[model samples]
Target: MQETPFCLRVGHLLPYSMLDSNITNFTKTSTFILLGIPGLEAAHVWISIPFCTMYAIAILGNFTILFIVKREPSLHGPMYYFLCMLAITDLVLSTSILPKMLAIFWFNSREIDFSACLTQMYFIHCFSAMESGIFVAMAFDRYVAICDPLRHSITLTNPVVAKIGLAVVLRGIMLILPYPLLARRWPYCRTSIIPHSYCEHIALVKLACTDIRISSYYSLSVAFFVIGLDVVFITMSYTQILRAIFSLPTKDARLKALGTCSSHLCVILAFYIPTLFSSLLHRFGHNVPLHLHILIANMYLLVPPMLNPIIYGMRTKQICNRLLWLVTRKGT
Candidate 1:
């Protein structure tokens, strides 16, 4: 005659056994409670406002980039093609987390079904990897355009660009597919409360009852391998491009060459700096505040998407001119 569990005792007090059935159903469904930015629960409504605003801006900006690029025949070059892919990736990457994040913040709805959580986790990471790959492709585009101007068009032809896009997608899928599959097999016997806004891999893995070293190590390995390799490639391309630019006789020629890459460089920094900072904080910042980590994580997703289009629109002369033309036309 052991004492009944407190949960069951509470369940017994409810009419029609509703609480009992809900508990039973929740157990079967295995939902995870997202405690979005813990220790700041009181300010969730206030927090939601900025997040919602950024999300709206990201959506509008990215869609405008896509629309402008598609409608403008002059923008049908390799560089703009990669920009289009990037805008699409940014849209997917931001949309995958922001809506659910906003929901958690605005409505206090935090229960995410386990499978749905895994799906969200996959999309977020997958698109992030894809975005990185796209950046690499863009860096290469600049390299070819500046360093090997003669071969720029012949090298990154439409077919080549299409192939590169496919490779980027496949690489992201292949690298991230293991995350959800492995996570699904692990037993989440511990508390289902995740302290972050989204189903981040490490945060989810921490809930497993058994050894999670494999998952942890694999994630570290993939991050290093993918990001490390891409950074190396981009750095190498830029080094050559710099050398090539310096070789130009006129200062204006060098300036023009560097100007072509200004937008890409800005976008790359916007994407990678916060990402690496967030990753390092997660792995090594034992004394760092949880809210800081969560805020950085959310910002990495939101800031890049919101800023990429704006950066391109302002820095890339063609896009800026076209955007102005469209606005002026609409005004009249």
Candidate 2:
């Protein structure tokens, strides 16, 4: 037998990536396959039920809040206007991921184009930041109402609320815009499979071939400053509100004061608690199951959107009466 050439033998022994630097740069595939939940293909039938229910409730509930707020002249105020903004934002967030998630769970259609994935990732981070900002805005609204009731109207006037709304949008957009820009700078590897149901920032960044330390730092700093500072600001706002409430002369006055803030406080907790769990798990709890991470992440988006209307509707008499009147009027 003839001896094999040293050149061919040496090439065969070397890794494909070692042969060419360009070969290690990027994936040939332009689309990514989302692995919805590993080891649960057999149970997707069961998993999609609660998800579909939550999506339906979220959509219907938020739109109802918008409609009632718009129709009832009594509901036209800074609080209701802000609630409408929250509803719209929730709709955007729910729409961004839920449809695709259901398709993945029900139809196994998990492939997303690179551009589309980046777009989805952008909105997910954007709206989540917006929600946190909105929460802080709402807390400020509460503080003014509770602590400075006499000037609340003059302070949060139409022009002022509009400016606050604009600022919220700008804050969310400006901070999160860098994330996708930085993400696209890196080259993806051939295995463009993401291990989650949705196109998330971390999920996309994890697929990059280049060193993403700078990108990760940027994302984390933005998240910490945006979310962490919002939490602290909101807590401080409530502290002031509480001090003012304590100064009120009567028990009923104090309870009524706290009552108005209850619904918003509920929403803040619902939005942040799951978010904290998901963020913590994503960053630190590597040993946690992938399915659990996905579930918590989904809840972070779903639970607040679904529960906000219920919490506020039941807590706020104006909303409850309006909703009931609408239903009974339609029935008649």
Candidate 3:
């Protein structure tokens, strides 16, 4: 007799012969196949070029930000400390997805072990949450610096900043830990083919044969709780900041104060707009093309990390000056 197929072997152990048909396509193995992009498979190699470039820029830019902040003693303030945290989070966020995505696009190496996929999913979302929290902290730092300048030093002391950092990390961990844990409990009896580049939370959950409303509701709740709450905090902080800036007696004073916030505002918009657009597109863009959905999702991860360092490097006087000095010294 011919040997039973690997996927159906488990059915033979059961008492019923009729179960074989139901179990024929069940994924008994822990491997998942990642389709780089559903309909655009032919262009994957070309698509990888820009994706690789953006990932490289993200790595270089964030590292440069960390190095500059670390080396310059004058930058050892609350703002720069939060910036360092942001840089680290951005590095992790992009790194978690890009390499595997590039592997999928360029080499057609699309297999991701189940556990590895969960780990990737955890890192991507966790760091994204941490990045958002860090932005909130940075906004608070600006608010304190501008609105209550007299007590800024006392308010955001080293201990305070360190505690805030710890809270951001813990919040990210506590909140995002459920995604993988809940995902692990689901039975992926369906085919293990994921139709996107990375192991996105919703994408993985959809592969499960069980009812996934819990997972869906939990994911939505976390998004609103983390991103929504953080956005509100940031808005409130900036409102106070704007009020304080406009109340200043001199036009020059207002412009200078607003200048301090320009880079941060740009970074916030860069991060939020793409993220919200992608989330909305994923949920409600039923008529949208699958390739477009995947492309937007990939862009959301790439654009913010690439733009953040560039925005800060251009807008912040100190970082720009330091970069110029470093270049001139290297030239000599």
Give the clash count for each candidate: 0, 0, 0
Error of 2 at 228 (Å): 0.6
Task: Please give the CA lDDT of all the candidate structures.
Answer: 0.87, 0.85, 0.89
> With candidate 2 superimposed using the best TM-score fit, by how many Å does residue 169's alpha carbon deviate from the native?
0.2
- For model 1, the stretches where C-alpha displacement exceeds 4 angstroms are 1-28
Q: Please write out the lDDT profile of model 2 over residues 224-330, one tens digit for every residue.
A: 99999999999999999999999999999999998999999999999988988888988888777677777788889888889988898999999999999989999
For candidate 1, write residues 281-330 as lDDT tens digits: 98888777787888899999999999999999999999999999999999
Clashing pairs in 2: none
Instruction: Report the C-alpha displacement of residue 314, candidate 3, in angstroms.
Output: 0.4
Name the weakest run of 10 consecutive residues (lDDT summed) in model 1.
6-15
TM-score of each: 0.92, 0.91, 0.92
Cα lDDT of candidate 3 equals: 0.89
Q: What is the C-alpha RMSD of each candidate to the true structure, in Å?
A: 5.5, 6.5, 6.2
Alpha-carbon shift of residue 14 in model 2 (angstroms): 24
Worst 10 residues of 3 by lDDT: 7-16
Error of 2 at 217 (Å): 0.4
